[model samples]
Target chain A: MHKFANPTFFMKIANGIFPWATGISILCFAVGLPLALIISPPDYQQGDTVRIMYVHVPAAWMGLMVYGVMAASSAVFLIWRHTIAHLVARASAPIGAVFTALCLVTGMLWGEPMWGTWWVWDARLTSMLILFFLYLGYIALGDSFEDQERGDKAAALLALVGSVNLPIVHFSVEWWNTLHQPAIFGLKGFSVNAAMLQPLLLMVAAFQFYYIAVLVIRLRAELLSAKIRTARFNLAAAE
Target chain B: MTRKRRRLYFVGLGLLGLFSATALMLTAVEDNIVFFFSPTELKARTVAPEQRMRVGGLVEEGSVNKSGGTVRFTVTDTVESLTIQYNGILPDLFREGQGIVAEGRMGRDGVFLANDVLAKHDETYMPPEVADALKKSGNWHPEGATAQAAEAKPATTSN
Candidate 1:
């Protein structure tokens, strides 16, 4: 576990996987975009507007999944005092926020045409909006303290606390009277037709790879900043 | 105790307090949840005028009326019904005898004045409550439940 936390070792692993992550993600988008927009038949009810599902569903999944990653990494940082874990949580915040924003925006576009409104304060949407705010709050809190160590710890704690919103966002439709429909992929079977399912799953995979590629890049940058800080300290000591 | 252990305890307590506060807030707001009501459920309770709520079920046969830009329709579970008035273009999927959900509040005159109406994203999809209510009303015939048949049913009923 300590070996995995070492910056040099972690960067080696990140560099190795970076190329594959970017390559597969680009391939996925290349295929997924066309299939989602053209090949797949429009919903019998929704027509062309249903095409938005490809981007919206994947973004929503990433918004929740990235938060989960941040939360887990944050817990590891808090428990084990691993700087890498905290760095990871910090790096993921903005990406998660972007995905959450995409989910909201696409949802609005779809809602206006199909649900007949651009927004509603319903369970699913309200929880998702809150999730977006939580990401923003975490980002801001990470830089609020003067002490860098204290700021990192506080941000890790915030990430852990904010994780409670994830389950609420997911189950809001089931637990409350919500405007959103239940998930398409259920325990029983895929609720959506195969034609739509293919592109949706591909887009989800694409986003997952996108996260991995971006995270490694950011993690490398974080490590470089840490080295620079140490070098600055050394120069001051020499002075 | 070590400083690290003390810090851990503080964080543990903070999380506990935060979670409890969230739980309490959720409980306090429970009544305002406004679950989707079938027309039957809507009938059983009195919703105050301008209180936002959702009513979902099948659009009643031969009930949708268009005049200029305004549209009025009755939504039903076959047992009870609510009149909805709207001044907007309905979703492409909106048709009589098809499952839909409308979000709005009661007008002072008792009619539901809806600003939004939602139809299922797919023909195969039916809001569970709408299906249950239709079944309860003994009017659920799966063979004729296609969107095309739904479009035809209202016209035939009008004739």
Candidate 2:
């Protein structure tokens, strides 16, 4: 772990992973999207609106997964003082936030015809909303302090706090007598048919690859920026 | 291993503490996001009558019918119509020719049975999907009395 902690060594590994991850993401998206958007049959009940699920479900999954990643990275950063982990957590915020926003918008679109309103005070929806806000908070706190280290620590703290919301978001639909639909994917017997399930799982795989791709690129950029900062500081000391 | 590492360890512990607390708070409040829908989209896309939805549109003028506890009306974006049925008493803003949103399931009989209704009491409002559907239908007229008077009402409103 300590050997890999060297930023130069990390960058060597990251460079190799970046292209492979990007290629995989593109390939997954190309295959998964059509299967989701066209090849997959509409819901026996929802009709065409079920297409929104392809976008909405994966985004919801990304949102939760990214937060989980952020919290885990935050733990590593705080405990190990790993700069790469901090960069990874920082890099992930905006992408995760975007996915959460997409989830909310697509959800609103899906709910209108089926639920009768554009918005609802349901368990699932509310927890997701909070997740969105948490992402926003992480971004804000990460940049809030004058000392960059302080800012990073603050954001790490925020990410850890926000991680707890994820399980609640997943289970809220079940615990409360809300209008939101119950979980389609669970450890108990699966509710979704094989046709819809296959594409959904594919999309999930695609999104995971996409997140990894983005994180590597962003982390590299962050490392480069830090290097530039150090170079400038040394030049000033020499002068 | 070193003092700096020890310092980082404490910071990690602090983050874990903060994370657990916020997670609890968010879980406690996890019941507040609402969904919105327009009347026309509900008509075109909703295949199952029993599937739940949130239906939004202007309550057509003179279309609201009340018989005892039940109220029946046609929600319109002027291009498409969806019938709504609500059994409970409605809010004061639930008026004919006003923008309202209803949440419930579509009955197999092409009627929307609302469990809850929300009215946009203010004037500066139209459900966002109304504009989207109208754009698709090539009927871009803004809804309200002035616009209704300007263009010929569509085929369904006369019913």
Candidate 3:
């Protein structure tokens, strides 16, 4: 892990993996979309509206999973003082925010048809909204400080503080009487039928690979900017 | 200790304090955070007449009746049930023996006066064919059985 602190080495590995990530993500989407949209049976209750879960659930999962990655990388940055770790956290924010936004939008679409309300202040829904805000807050706070290091530290702390919401978001349905339903996949077993689960898993994998491909691109840009900043500082000192 | 080690400890302790504080606050506000109350909870706790709240449970089988613009139904948590009267459009998913939540106030006449009605579906999802097979085999039970076990039992037993 410490060896990855070297930017050149890190980029080498990232470049190697980027093509594979993009290819697999596209392949998964090629298969998963049809499976989710056309082949998978309409729900006994929800019919075609159930198809929305293919996108909504995976987006929600990505939102949470990306936040987990962000928080973990933030921890690594703070503890190890690794610039690459900070870059990883910074690169993750916008992508996670988009995924969260997708989750919310798709949820509203499904909710209007099924639940009769576009939104509700239920514990699960409210906590997820907070997650979205946390991502925005992390991004805003990171840019607020003029001193880049200070900004990074502050944002890292915020990321750690906000992690308390993750468990609350997950268990909110179980802990409270929410309009949202409980998790179909639980410790006991999947309550969903195999036919639906297959497509859902495929979409989840597709999203995971897509996140990785995008993260590598973002990280490369971040590295270039850092190099430029350092070069400018060196030129100023020589003058 | 080295400076890096000290920073690590400082960060670790700060996080610990933050988590404990959050945990305490969440516990303190547990009641306020709950989205709705079941019929059993409503009955156990005294609520002021006409106080706004949400009640959730399964729509009792054979209990929905529509009269003009008003729709009346019974919501049962399998332990206790409440009569709800709503004067609005129900969601597409609203049906007898399905989960629903009604937001309104308790009336003076013992019926709940709901201004909004939202259908709450369970977690279970399957193809119509699988659902039919489950029904035919007499093994189909709705998810969250605690709330719908009574209504679902008779159908299963008859089969």
Best by DockQ: 3
Q: Which residue window of length 10 is worst by lDDT in model 1 chain B?
A: B150-159
User: Positional deviation of A60 in candidate 1, in angstroms?
Assistant: 0.6
Docking class of 2: incorrect
TM-score of each: 0.83, 0.66, 0.95
The DockQ scores of all candidates, in the order shown, are 0.20, 0.07, 0.51
Task: Give lDDT: candidate 1, residue B117.
Answer: 82
lDDT of 3 at A186: 78
First chain TM-score for all predictions: 0.98, 0.95, 0.97
For model 2, how does the per-residue alpha-carbon lDDT over B106-156 read when each residue is reduced to its tens digit? Answer: 787878899887654221112234334445666554333323321232341
lDDT of 2 by residue, A120-164 (tens): 666677889999999999999988899988999889878876777
TM-score of chain A of 1: 0.98
| Local lDDT at B8 for model 3 | 85
TM-score of 2: 0.66
Taking all chains together, the TM-score of candidate 1 against the true structure is 0.83
Question: Which candidate has the top score in TM-score?
Answer: 3
Most accurate candidate by lDDT: 3
Error of 1 at B116 (Å): 4.3
Q: How should the candidates be ordered by DockQ, best one leading?
A: 3, 1, 2
lDDT of 3 by residue, A196-217 (tens): 8889999999999999999999
